[model samples]
Target: MDKTQNPNNNEMVIDLVDLAKALWRRAWAIVLVMVIFGGAAFGYARFLVTPLYQASAMMYVNNSSINVGSTQVDLNDLTAAQSLVETYIVILKTRGTLEQVIEEENLPYDYETLSGMIEAGAVNSTEVFEIQVTSADPEEAERIANCVAEILPDRIAEIVEGSSVKIVDYAIVPSQKSSPSISRYTLLGLLLGAVVSCGIIVLLYLFDDQIRDEEYVRQTFDLPLLAAIPDLTGKNSGSSYYYSKKTSGKEATP
Candidate 1:
């Protein structure tokens, strides 16, 4: 076979051993890339990202009314209170309630900003609802939540005309941040780095055209028995020669 010709050049055959060897040769580069990306993600999550704290207060809707004659609580009033919990959640974030909270708390923020920070939701199917506030400052978050708790009950009483709202739990300053998960970001960085490194390795392997071993030569040319000439140079120098015989049994060395 001619030295320049290739027999197994169909482009569909894949040799896993060659692929593994190629990746092993560049293992250090892949590891370095992985470390760099993972460290960058950790640093960004730990130092660059702003952490927010959340504070929450719980309020209960009590629509129960006493019968003057019997002095017993009305069942229909209690059921009405349960249904009003959802309506109270909507009113809690309204401009009227939020502006009152901001004014009472002396917050240096507008109604929109205060409203954006406040979250109110009914607790399951019960007549209880929770109000939460998130801010960069823990104390501010707690203060805002508590102020909403204090003002919303009276506001609800005025709006519903005899319905009662009571505070069940007061907001406290949160000790821990609510977001910026370091471990999760680091793991994502690791996976991203590994995928990028593997892609680079694959690209390099596909683009490389140099044949590094005798097996590649034989596979490319579909050649029969042939002697190999080993290059001897530098400190590992030894010997280099080649011999081949023709059909006439005449031996030639070059």
Candidate 2:
């Protein structure tokens, strides 16, 4: 048996070189596709999508007795404050708090919509929590965040009866929009475009069964080459050529 006739050796394999050649052949199409997708993403981010601004207010919990002196700090009080911070976070998102915020701010949105835009969480494992609000208007986000900060204390006081919540940092109007990230969108678009373009190129390469080179024909037929016919097309007459077997054992060329 011929060593070359082994099934493993005869199996067709696609390699990096073939992929590179395929991509090179379709470079223009891939570039066009990338440009189209990238432009669309830029347009959407810059013009079509609504920009959103975020504002955050931080508050600290003091879950100690009211009679305790300000100068005296206890470890137990600190631990209690840290534990109660999570409870305050939940209370901040309750319907009552959100309703009050909507009423005081005269917001156009309802409780569910307003709740969706508001985020409250403890800062790590500490006794501090932050209230973040996102909206289309920068001033509105700031106002909502501050409003929540103001009302959250009263709500917490009502719930825990004696806990103190103090605003550590007030919300400020953001100078820049947070949503519709142009750079991120553009990068995603570029990646998506490249993936789609590569997929199309691979599909085209797979479906194209026509023999393109002497090596392909030789591999497919297990035959020895004899001669080559040069394609005299004006565009690629200097580069493009094909191989053919001649009746004589000697090689021939054209």
Candidate 3:
């Protein structure tokens, strides 16, 4: 048995050089298709999709007041507190909170639609949680974010104690818009499209049995290659005479 016949033999494996050569042969077509699709996706993401501005307020819960009777919270109590925080985050997003915000800010949209854009999440490794509000209007996002952050702790404190919970950090009005990350979104789309297009090109090349290489001609016809005739466009650039001579020789053969 031939040593090369073993599937484990590195010599029998597909080479990067061969794969690159195949890709280079079809580079122009790939570029043309990818450019077209990339431009289309970029335009749609930029111009067609609605822009959303986000404003977030961060807060840290220190758990400052410790009870002497029940001095330390057990694992179950900690889990339950985290669960309650998550629930309050949801409640902070409801119409009740939005209604207060809308009445205070005199917003144009109804509570239901306006509350849809708001999002909240706890920061990992710490008791810090963020209340983020998003909208087409920058001021609305800022207003909603500040209102939610203000009312949330007070409401939570009322359930837990007689006095207000201490606020570690106050919500500052954000000046920058957060959504439709143009550079990030565009770059991500370009990268994704490139990978998908490259995979498709590779698959097509693998499955295609078309005779496009000098090696294919030599193996199929059992002919010795004296010369290779490149694409007509490439030949016309500087090597017309050499390519014409090769074509003439092939034609002269009986």
Candidate 4:
């Protein structure tokens, strides 16, 4: 028979169908491993990991005074407000402001710890930026965020001569947790379990060299099949031949 042209004639790789069969044969085992790992991950995330809540406050940066009933506005002022966000972020993250916040709230955390929990960023490249504070307790997160909102404006005004920040919205207590996602952890655990299990099975299938039957031999060793026989005597065993000995001296007893 004529075979199609191929680029890789000698390169050998594991058959995907066989690998899939091996995985399917151990489907129950794989599911069990996935469940075990997923349960463990869920337990760890739900019970052991500490949950955090986040409270957010919004602030607007005012670059200059806007005249009343103005038909047109200067685009440069809007651009200036956007540019001022970076400088304001730097001042907001300073140790001095955080120290004052710690003093005002009587929080136990130091500057580094408190700074790690706070996040500040511009809202969609606009003049409005948001400040978020995360804590183990929702009420504490709200308190810290509100305290920053109350303290940051005057602090910025004092530092930057003309620049000032105005509070657009105050912080409110968060109703839901912001971290320690149980479902995500569980899914990751399940995926890891599946990868490990399937990897081991595939490795075993690829490295195994034991012969199973005649068909396996023909496919792997490129040997021609000489003959084959059906099972006889109702025994599920390997092939065996039986024959009567030739009658040498005794006459044939038809």
lDDT order, best first, reads: 2, 4, 1, 3
From the highest TM-score down, the ranking of the candidates is 4, 2, 1, 3
Cα RMSD for candidate 2?
5.2
Q: Which one wins on TM-score?
A: 4
- TM-score against truth, every candidate: 0.70, 0.80, 0.59, 0.82
Question: In model 4, which regions exceed 4 Å deviation?
Answer: 1-11, 223-254
Model 2 per-residue lDDT tens digits across residues 99-213 = 9999999999898999999988888878888889999999999999999999988888888977879999999999999998999898888888989999998877766656556
Which scores greater on lDDT, model 3 or model 4?
4
Minimum summed lDDT over a 10-residue window in model 4 is located at 245-254
Each candidate's number of clashing pairs is 1, 0, 0, 0
Residue 90 deviation, candidate 4, in Å? 1.0
The CA-based lDDT of model 4 is what?
0.81
Pairs of colliding residues, candidate 4: none
lDDT of each: 0.78, 0.81, 0.62, 0.81
List candidate 1 segments past 4 Å from native.
1-21, 65-83, 214-254
What tens-digit string does per-residue lDDT give for candidate 4 at 1-254? Answer: 11111224744555667778878999887888889889999999999999999999999998765554778878887888898998998899999999999998999999999999999999999999999999999999999999998889888988997778899999999999999999999999999888877788777776776544555544553444444454576665665332222333222110
Worst 10 residues of 2 by lDDT: 1-10
lDDT of 3 by residue, 176-237 (tens): 66667767666776776677778887887556545445544443333455556544676354
